[model samples]
Target: MYTEHPGSCSTTGAIGLERTRFFPRQLITPDDLIQDQIYFRDKLRRHNRLLHGWGVVCGARIKPGTGECEIVIEPGYILGPYGDEIYIDQEVTVNLCQQGTDGNAISPCSDMTDPWCSNIRVDRQSNKPYYLAVRYAECQTRPVRVVGTSCGCNEIECEYSRIRDSYAIKLLSELPSTYADPMPQPNLDDVARCTPDHACPACPTEPWVILADITLGAGSKVTKEGIDCFAHRRHVVSFANYYYLCKSTTLPVVRSIFPGNGINLNNDQALLREWAQRPLLKITFDREMAMPKLSEPDAWLRFWQLRSDDNLTVVRRIFLALSPENPPATDESGFTATYQLRAGAQELFQSRFLIQIRATADTITDTTTPPNLLDADFSGTKLSSEQLNQVWNVTDQTTLSIEILNNLSTTDATLPSGDRAAGGQFHSWFAVLG
Candidate 1:
């Protein structure tokens, strides 16, 4: 006999023997899988929301000033039994919440009356969350105003005007009530009735005076005879082979040199003869003819021409003239000239020196002579002044020394020969101009 049953299958063997086997039926459907997916997605969203709330709480605690709170959301994935390991990650949304010091919910509102209350919000384009911060201040009661007597009319008026211009009415209202009131309005009638005293300011008794003096040397005396004054006074000094006439007076004084005790020269005589008449001070030469002419029309012109023609050549001549045995001091192959200004303890306003040199070159050669012979190889380096006003503003008892460097490499060149060489001279003089 064969029997049939639900979820059971019967099979007969080839010899007519019977056997029964049972198979389980499938109960789950496609709808159930869909429901499972929804359930997991909702769970992940809830977890994300909880994390965002936590982030907001953390931000609010450390919020700076009056800034609001911020929140951030992150998305991720998880493995599951459904589909191909179910999608565990979902889109995350950030939410912001305002909380008070008591941990209770509060609105993000800034108080206008409170100067310290401030609100701020920040947004970022990256995955970083938005930030909010709030700063709060304790409220205070307004104080009563107190009026006080106002004096110093001018000063009070200035203060009132400044405060009114700078601060708004609302800010002014917040000031302490005890603050002084605005200055009283000016009295037009009283101002009109007052007498006007229009006297000019008092003038100074002695209007400042500038005195300029030029001195020759320690023992030498400065007299009106040696000075030629036009708009200013000119002092003459002799140093080495040259005579210098430096203007020693300021711009205001105008005294002619020839009228008073100035140098008297015969106009009919030769220019050279008149130059010889001028007294030589603080300088001496071996021979009379060695002194260059410094008389009339051409004397001044020749003086400047010698200096401007070739400064280096003139400097070498002057160096030899000062002391024939003392050629410029040598540093390796180069030469240098040193000069000392012996002011002693005298304090001077302005000091100037005029130097002159004259000599004939007996021997000249490209190799033996200095390169760029015409260039001013010797510069007034130590005591040199750039502008006119760069006066030697020295302290009391201080003496100034100057060094002149010679760029020539003619270490082998011998000094000039003949009477002129022995008699050659370099002259310099000092003058104070204030």
Candidate 2:
């Protein structure tokens, strides 16, 4: 049998006697451990409360003779609010001051002739204070009148009104670097594979067949809105070359060994040389006349290629030009002109590929002035490698047709009325076997 003692060993054995004689320890009970935990928890709570406290002040004021009021805020040693919650990064600060009509200092409360609001708060990052001031006024309240008539025929009237509008501040996170700095834009000049020279092709590396060369004789007249001026041409290609230029034996192939009979390499050499003579198309905008108006008229030059089956491919380009005269009035009214390129129904390139002139006018007030010349050069490669590949992959021997549609419309209500004459040359090319 074992008996328990409060402070000593109850067993009367040599082992118990040895333990009691050699080792001594202080006893801690469950209650004591629980008390220690509570003490530490309270200390942590007090420390946290000291670190985070109400650190922002808000102020409000009315704008004199106006219905609007501005709210001011000052931050203390704490992070500013992001949305409804506070953020840790404290890089921003608010500045506010009260100024008189002549830009002189004025008392925030009494010296201010106009309503004013001022407040201060500290920033969490620098642990510095910031001040803010805002003007406020009521915008949408109407006065109510009360009238009383006494028995003696005397009337009394009273009006009731008060400024009850208020404004609050909301902070949003800054945009990420990826959005702040975007990728470089593509340029038409960089992508254009063809030029205007009829003697030389723009892309000498690629085989080309001359399809059509139509000289716009006298230039078409464009006057009314939504009206279209057009030029059209027809072309055709052989079936074998259209379907199997790469696989056809008639086209030369580089052989590893010369045949014992000897082979003529002129055809193969000619095929490669044909790259220099690839076909090209060019359009020129010549004379333009305008009737001075408050607004400017927009014009579009559209080019389309059609196959025998009526499949249509659209080509787009943008041209930008500035006014040549540099008038003072024109300077006050900034001007911009652009011609954009599209594929089928989608617009792929815009301001980047434009042919920019020295001057751009959004509104044409002087119609009598001579029109500025706008020129743009384009190549099949401008369609992008993927788009060009899609065109080359067509299997059918189709009648290649081309058309240019010129249109003009008003972009603004005050656009000037105008009659413009435009003339240009059109050239189309196809891949062919030499």
Q: Residue 392's C-alpha lDDT in candidate 1?
A: 19
Summarize candidate 1's per-residue lDDT along 46-131 as a digit string, tens digits.
34333221111111111112222222212222211111111213232212233323221222121244455442222223222121
Whole-model Cα lDDT of every candidate shown, in order: 0.22, 0.23
Model 2: weakest 10-residue lDDT segment is: 251-260
> How does each model score on TM-score?
0.13, 0.14
lDDT, candidate 1, residue 323? 28
Per-residue lDDT, model 1, residue 316, is 12
Clashes of 1: 21
Q: Which sections of candidate 1 miss by over 4 Å?
A: 1-283, 290-349, 361-434
RMSD (Cα, Å) for all candidates, in order, is: 41.3, 35.5
Q: After superposition, how far is residue 119 of candidate 2 from its true place, in Å?
A: 14
Where does model 2 exceed 4 Å of error? Answer: 1-128, 133-144, 149-157, 161-418, 424-434
Q: State the TM-score for model 2.
A: 0.14
